[model samples]
Structure formats: C-alpha cells, structure tokens
Target: MPEQPQWSERTLDMPPQDPWADQPTAPGTVPTPPPPADPAPFSRGRAQVNPQPHHTQRYAEHEPTGIGWPGAEAPGAPHGMTWRWSELRRGSEWTTAAVLFAFVCWGIWALSGGGPLGTPLIVFAVTLAVAVGVFCLARVVGYVVLERQFGRRRRTARGSHLVTALFLAGVGVADLQQTQWVMDAYHWVAGQIS
Candidate 1:
C-alpha cells in the first residue's frame, strides 16, 4: 500500500486577530473635546438693517477692447446702452470667418474629383465672400455715421458673456464644417494625384 499522507502531523495556520477587536482595554484610550470660542460683544442700541455702501463698481465697466481680442462691447449712451458697436463687429467677424472657411473648403472639395458641384462651389464661395464683405463694409459705414451724429465718450468695452457665446458657437460650427470639407478635399486630391 502507498505510504500514508502526513495528515496526522500537519496543521493549518490561522490569521492573527485584529488589534482593534472588541476587547476590554486595561489603559486609557479616550479622546478629549476642544475649547469653546469667545462670545461676540453686544451693543446696547437698536440694530439698523441698512448696511454701508461699497465703493467698487461693476467689474464689466473696466473690460478692454480690440479686433483679435474676440468680444468687445461697443460704446453707446452715457448710462447703459443695449447695443454696443464693437460687439456687433465681433459677431460679424466671427460669422464672416466661419463662412469664408466653409467656402474655401467647398472650393477645395470641387477642385478634387468630388462631383458636379465644382462651379456651384466656386459661385457659392464668391457670393459668400461678397456678402460678408459688404455686410462688414456696411457696418463700418453705419458705425461712422452714427458716431458722427451721436456725441459723447466713444470708449469701447470688452466683450460680454453673450458676445463670447456667439463667437464660440460660430467657431464650433466652422470647426465641424471643416472636418467634412477637409475629408472631401482630401479624397478629391488623392483621386486626382493617383
């Protein structure tokens, strides 16, 4: 018969008990509470609800202006004007740029072996360029004429949240259009080169 396994002498090792097990301790292990805060000083008179006014003006009053700077609010009436010329210009610029980029993309797409839209693409691009350009020119004329008529401080302000939102939206659309335009152009060019 085979030799009997050494089960009689072997034993399994068990894990050690946790130090924090629920056992009674012989030493002190309690925590202490922190000191309390001092009481506020009391005034004897009747309290007035009206608080002192602060000197700081609105943060928007001090924003800067420019072309590449994105959104800059245009100057208007002395108090608070609804439309700022600068903001309009910025919006127009964003629109124009997006349209132009799209047009160029279309042109590129046409040049490639794309389809029957080559001539149409070119026409569309030209029309977009002219329309946007005219709109920009009209804005310039309108601003100059209005400024000449209305007298006061012509200071330009930085863009507001609304203007920024408009710009970002336009840019987002342009970016999406770019993907399609670029892909089509690439295929067209590739087909031609090969």
Candidate 2:
C-alpha cells in the first residue's frame, strides 16, 4: 500500500480560527466538541435511561440501512400492482355473466316454467352480484382517498368494511324484492334533474 501523506504535505482546507483565541482560559479547562446531528428526527431532548441496553451502547457505530426483514407480503392487498379497468375486465365479465344468469332466472319465473328453483336462483345471483360489486368498488376506490391522506399505514382494516357491505347488500336485496327502492330512487333523481 502507498504511504499516507503527513498533514503538512497534504492539500487541506484551513480550519476556522476561534474568535476567542486571544482570551486567557481558566487553568486546566478542556474545550468541548460540537453536539452530534439528530438520529431520529422531529424529537425534543431525550430522557436518560436507567439501564441502557448493551447493543445500543454503540448507538451510532453502524451505518444506517433502511431495509426491512424479507417475508411474504401480508395476504390480501393493495400490496403489488394497482388494479385498473384493464385489470378488472375479467371481473366485469364475470359480473356481466352473473347478471345475465339472474335475468334468465327471472325470465323463467316470469314465464311460470321453473317454479320452485326460480326465486332461489335469482336471490343467490343477486347476492353474488352484490358481494362481487362491493369488492370491485373497494379495490378501485379504496386507495384513492386513503393513499392521499394516510398512506398504506392509515388504511382502515377491511374486515369491518366487508361485513358492513354484506349487511347493506342483504338489506338492498330485501328492499329490491319488497319496496321497489330502485324505482323510487330513479324517479327521485329524474325529479332532481328536471
């Protein structure tokens, strides 16, 4: 290895001279070094720990590494690959197929052909449609407001949302059969438009 250069022989910038260099110091006084830059940001002065951990004794010894321990992503997502209309086309197709099947079931009931099985099939299809629609809408719009406001950490746990959606869907289907709320809402919207 090449020999290191002496400080006198090296090219170096001059250190700033102390303004108080001319002042006489108190006998045996030691000058203090500058305080370190903050470790974690946005913090006030720290409290003393009674028993500091051995590992943390050399707190600033290691260089920072921002990586986390690797593992499988937590199961269901908003994890990788944002779902767009193109990605959701397959789901749209399935929904369309389900709706058609429900229509066919309704027609069979209307014609008075398939009596016992007809109503059950229509109910089942509508339920499936509601469940699938809830999930699709969630996937599409869940992140829009959430990601803007709170990032990934602030996402509301989806289990409650799913449960609430399912309950509403059940109520909607019941209202569809008994109350004709869709017709009422359509007329209400038309009145508002007019």
Candidate 3:
C-alpha cells in the first residue's frame, strides 16, 4: 500500500490595527480653545481713515501735447482711452508674422514637388487660410471696436490683419486651381491702387 500523503495546518495573518481606531481616550487628550485677544493691544493702529476732497488729483485745463516723449500720443486722443490699444496692436502684429510664415512654408513645399493642387497642398493652404483668417479677422475687429469705443484714432487704427486675412484666403482660393484668377484680380487691384 502507498503511504498516505501528509498535510500541514494553514493560517492567515491579519493586518495591524490602525493607531487612530475608535477608542475612548482621557479628557486631557482633547484640544483646548485659544484665549481671547487682548483689548488694548488689538485696538492700536485700527483708527478710522480720514478722507479729504482736496487731496484728489487735478488735470490741467489744456491737454498735454506728446508730453515731450517721441511717438507718444499726439495732441488728440479720445478720452477714456485705456491700455488695450497696445494689446490689439501687438496681437495684430503677431497674426501678420504667422500668416507670412505659413505662406513661405507653402511655397517651399510646392517647390519641393508637393504639387500645388495636390490634396496635401490644398489641405495645407485651406487650413492655413481658415486659421489665419479667423485670427486676423478677430484682431481687425478688436482694434476697430477698441478705437471706436475708447480712443479717438478710429480712422488711423486699421491694423495689418485685414490685409493678411485677404492674402491668406486668396492663397487658399488659388490652391483650389484658380491661380490665374487670383493673379488677375491682384494685378487689377494694384493697378487701381496705383
């Protein structure tokens, strides 16, 4: 007869109990509230402010002319003009730079045998046109509205974003196989302008 197999007893070890387990504690272990603030010490330097009407700033009867600073605001600027003029101006500049760079990249890609009307080129031009157009249109609208709403330079504040948007959109149209039309329109417009 084969010998019977032997088995040993098995047991599982439990995890350690948490130190913060619910248990009764001595009253001394409870936290105490902070003492009240001292009256005399807290009252120091808390006196009421005294406002004076005469202390307000006074503007000159006549407006300042450039304030001796070159390229500063000319003799005429709309009242209530805030600092946002600078913001719109800078944003328009960056939009112009991005559109220019996209055009350069598109030209280089086409010259490298990425056929001008190929799917990739069309996609590139159209996508770039849409993106640049949206950004520049927003920029143009912003400065125009800003000037109308704030500064007095509404006539002179037209940004480069308008031209950039038109140029980018024209490239996209050209990519759709209408290059001759774009060139003709461009020449006609140039002739009219000149």
- Per-model TM-score, in order, reads 0.25, 0.28, 0.25
Q: For candidate 2, what's the RMSD?
A: 18.3
lDDT of 3 by residue, 28-53 (tens): 79755546646544344567879868
Cα lDDT tens digits, model 2, 113-137, are: 3347666667666766676667656
Give the lowest summed-lDDT range of ten residues in model 1: 153-162
Best by lDDT: 3
Off by over 4 Å in 1: 1-89, 92-115, 152-194
lDDT order of candidates, top first? 3, 2, 1
Query: What tens-digit string does per-residue lDDT give for candidate 1 at 120-158?
Result: 666565655555455545544444555545623334322
lDDT of each: 0.51, 0.52, 0.56
Error of 2 at 34 (Å): 54
